[model samples]
Target: MPDATFKIFRGDRDGGELYEYKVPIAPGMVVLDALHYIQAHDAPDLAVRWNCKAGKCGSCSAEVNGRPRLTCKTRLDALPLDQPITVQPMKSFPVLKDLVTDVSWNYRVNKKIPPFTPRPNVEWKMDQREVDRVQEFRKCIECFLCQNVCHVLRDHEKQEQFGGPRFFVRIAGLEMHPLDGLSRTELLKEELGIGLCNITKCCTEVCPEDIHITDNAIIPLKERVVDDFYDPVRWFLRKLSGKKH
Candidate 1:
């Protein structure tokens, strides 16, 4: 019924530029559909990474109008159809090709996090209610949109030191568990770089899964780090107990 122009970024590891393609628009269509149309008719070589069109897949992450969002979930109706929709590859990682970014950095960061370690119990069980608390975070499909939107990684390029928002959510989910045995407070502060997050809550806004990354994950880790190392009363109590800081 209508037509729209997509201003898409295209290129490889060396560099890239925005390329525009006008395509017919249909009702209830998403950005991913538009990209597919371009690839089908106009730009056969346009490279984009995606697995499932449904929201559950978390495969279609990109910057739509400079905001991190899953392309499959972003409908055309919500955007200003009069203007060319700008779709760019995520800024946090190396761009492999048009709209496809090398998300391997996230895998490296994930490795730095301690694997889920449950306390040694011949019989391992806990309150289902306790398990329910971390379930929302487990819903993360590893889209890394939250990581892309984070200012630390987006603007500052802190990829070397900071593990990004997704990992913070990972750490928060595991640390909050009632049965998990790994205390990562020291590691959180020192190695994983939880201290870099300023609690801007930007990550929570872009989550398609609706996970409370800032309040539930980062803040709790911040509090844990403070209590473990910086709390004066806790420090004095530990000193009285002849514990090392």
Candidate 2:
């Protein structure tokens, strides 16, 4: 209806500031449209990383009004237009420029996860329910919004010790797959720092895919980590067998 004011971050890893731009709102206009308008008419040098302006690409992830969201799917109508909409890079990652943050750290964490190893001499068949279980994890678009929102990474800066929620979801798919033989509970307990998560469910709240990240992926993984490392009976058995998780 009226013009919407956008306070978009501008600059690089060195430093940056929010430069305001006024955009005339249109019906069905999303935040990305306003950003494109700003790019064309106001600040040509503005660096906002985006692709496929639809929600699926996840390339347009940024903080809108201090909440991590995909700008492409964030409808301007849904936001309060009376005040300036603050668009900034995800705080969990280092800003490379404007709204773009360096997300390569996610890739590095992903590399640490072992690939799916199917059990030997196993039937290729699996129950439909089993397929459905892991399929939920496959929906992850790697927006890294979960990682950005997670307190472990966002607040504590535990990148060296934690793999963040995105990787936990990836590990969930591999670990839960009926045919997968490899066990990543050790990886989860040690490298990914699964114990660090307090299950605030902030990651699930920000997920555009609505994949139940907390209930389905992270919690079950936490249980696996506990069962493997904490259960008294399991601990006793491991000790008796001279085995280490």
In candidate 1, which residue ranges exceed 4 Å CA deviation?
243-245
Candidate 2 off by > 4 Å: 238-245
| Model 2 root mean square deviation, Cα atoms | 1.4
Q: Could you tell me how far off, in angstroms, the CA of residue 29 lies in candidate 2 after the best superposition?
A: 0.6
Q: Write the per-residue lDDT of candidate 1 for residues 1-245, one digit (tens) a residue.
A: 78998899988879988888898989899999999999999989998888989998888899999899999999998999899999999888789888889898899988888888887882576789988989978989899999999999989998888888899888888898887888888878887788888999999999999999898888888999999888999999988999764
Taking all chains together, each candidate's TM-score versus the true structure is 0.96, 0.96
Global lDDT for candidate 1? 0.89
Quote the positional error of residue 57 for candidate 2 in Å. 1.1
Q: What are the per-residue Cα lDDT tens digits for candidate 2 across 128-185?
A: 9999999999999888999999999999999999998999999999999999998999
List clashing residue pairs in candidate 2. Answer: none
lDDT of 2: 0.93
User: Each candidate: what lDDT?
Assistant: 0.89, 0.93
Scored against the true structure, residue 238 in model 1 reaches a CA lDDT of 89
**lDDT, residue 34, candidate 2:** 95
